[model samples]
Target: MNEPLTRQPEPEYMDLDDEAVVYAEADFADVNAAFVERLIELTPAPGPLLALDLGTGPADIPRRAVAARPGWRIVAQDASFAMLSIARRADRAMGLVQSDAKRLPFAPASFDLVFSNSILHHITNVEPFWAEVKRVAKPGAAVFLRDLARPDSAERAHAIVETYSGREPDLLKEEFYRSLLSAYTPGEIRGQLERAGLAMLDVALVTDRHVDIWGTVP
Candidate 1:
């Protein structure tokens, strides 16, 4: 059976009393930290790189990258004021902006590196996300985005949750399950990328439950 799509973003997610702590305590920071390491290795840009991080929940990825690379100026943005509030409390180094990813407040080609973590699945229509990613990114800008991949069936989704979030609290396990259902498969992401004129990006299954879109903007 096809898994039903379910997405809970921003206010609704933040309204949950456990949401903040769940994200704060989750073990996924290591995964995002690895993405940052890989991005630095792949990006050809030198020091003082201007970067934009979309949907920066608590700014964990930005925090990791900033600590490791002092020269990176990161503008971490999220649509949810609640999430931004949490991000602000987590780190003061990043410039936190509350803005929609589809219609960013910046000018064209404003950044050298654009990245996101697990934000794509929250978007119902992903075309706008890719369009905006291309618009804000400079020519040859490195992109590293990763998100959960929807399973082929609800049973598979349940199994994935059991495998990855079983040890977590009930709230987080449920949240992970919902995110998995909302996510797009690798094939779907490839189609969205092609439609958005981002066909050059490399779309791959980076993990059992996640798909990654990584490459330089053309």
Candidate 2:
């Protein structure tokens, strides 16, 4: 019988200067582009938009999003100063803020869209994080979040890492395995959504290794 995967929490922030820079420089063009494209497809709203991209590691998604939808005005926020500093170097018209996801600094209803990619598993207290995401969103705001899904066992996780990140360096492959171990399952995420009053959001396994939660706030 396969061992059940247990949730393993990782550091909340990727603040190490060297590591953050290395991460920011890595080639994530394909995945980042796909995320931006999917988000745009999910939200067909026209005109200028005030959007928030949480855990905006290197701000690659925001950069792609703005290029595709010129009307989007994104504020890329991250808790890691190292990550944000790297993102700051790139000339961008959108805003950037360094704040905790559980206690965002933005005002209520401040964003037309509140979205994040792969930040949920890092949070220790996800209920507050979900509430914060809900709080910052405008009425009818679109909420889109995506992150890895924990596999059933360490072996499965390792196989997944090898399949997807085989060409990547050992450092990234190790990190990817850790992230997979730390990831939340779709069922667990559904329970989080229920408790956080975000039950309206749909939680689904978007890919073999990732889960997606999305819906318009009521």
Candidate 3:
């Protein structure tokens, strides 16, 4: 497989528009809504929770969090202005910010929960991203991360992307394949969490493409 893109690309080049295509093709919006609700129900109440949605793509997860826990204060952060623009247009009440996952612009212990979905696989520096998550989250803060699990083969990765995109995404194929190659196994993810000063609480394969890992600040 070709090497993953080293630097962030323009949102248009990144095919932010394709998010809608993928969501529709996979019916992920509906599935994700239910999954988010279930995740919220499973989580213990962190009273008056201050939540951060890292890589808050299109703010779907953030919106779900807000709806599930009306009292929770949420900060939605994403690097793509196009994604953020779509999110802001959909929900005026959302607390949205444009920021990188690897370098969050927040003070230490600023949040009680940090969540990300379909985003971690895009990260080039997993260590720093997890470190920032740890740094900004309060002690004992909950963290929920869901990302594509490593594929068995590059062909599988490409097929999956094409399945959702409805066409070959040549511009992103290399990056997408690399992302799968770079993805962590359950054990590897847990190990990384430990190294990042987080204690793993739960880990599961949520679907064929997604792994759900939750942990807490050490």
Candidate 4:
């Protein structure tokens, strides 16, 4: 019998200048904007939300979120110095931290909101990622995580990439395909969340190629 599809892990960090540039240049404007809007709508009520963004590569999502809600105080965290440097160069985005997602340099229960976009699949050891999320978020903190869903096979992954990134640069398209291969399935991520004591959050497929794990921390 053929084995079920499995996640193909990729590098956890994009520390090189050219890699960071290729990623930062990719057009994620529509999806990133949608992520911010959906996150805002998910919050029960909002006034100066103290938000934490994990794996905030290039700082695009945080910047868009802050622009939509000026009261939000966001701190973007990434392990890649090159990515953060590009983010700063783009607009001098402040409060950026270059740290691994597993080792967040923040106090416990410190944030009203915790969110990440397209970062989950990059994590090789996902337990610490969710554990840190649960640890740093305040009680009842709104949590929204969006990531690509691993396709059933390489062919599907390539098709998804081509459909979405047809006009994108070759480098970007290749990276997108690799990311899809590396992304975790919904069941796998849910199990990870449960093991990390985050079973209360909801996990569901949000799109053909994406999964959204959302809801509030208990």
Give the poorly placed runs of model 1, Cα more than 4 Å off: 1-17, 44-46
The C-alpha lDDT values of all candidates are 0.82, 0.89, 0.71, 0.89
- Summarize candidate 3's per-residue lDDT along 27-101 as a digit string, tens digits: 357657865775586466746788898877677777777777788889998887767777888799899988787
Residue-level error in angstroms, candidate 2, position 140? 0.4
TM-score of 1: 0.90
The candidate, 3 or 4, that scores higher on lDDT is: 4
Which pairs clash in model 4? none
Displacement of the residue 49 alpha carbon in candidate 4, Å: 1.5
Worst 10 residues of 1 by lDDT: 8-17
lDDT of 4 by residue, 1-218 (tens): 55656778888898888889999998899999889989989975757889999988899999988888888999999999999998888767457988999988999999999999988989988888888999999998999999999988887888898899999989889889889989989999889988988889999998889999998898
In Å, residue 125's CA in model 3 sits off its true spot by: 1.2
Candidate number achieving the greatest lDDT relative to the actual structure: 4
lDDT of 4 at 34: 87
Per-candidate RMSD, Å:
2.7, 1.1, 4.8, 1.2
Better of 1 and 4 by TM-score: 4
Candidate 4: segments with Cα more than 4 A from true spot: none
The residue-by-residue lDDT of candidate 1 on 134-214, one tens digit each, is: 999999898999888887777888999998778999988888888887888888889998899999999999788879899
Worst 10 residues of 3 by lDDT: 5-14
Clash pairs, model 1 backbone: none
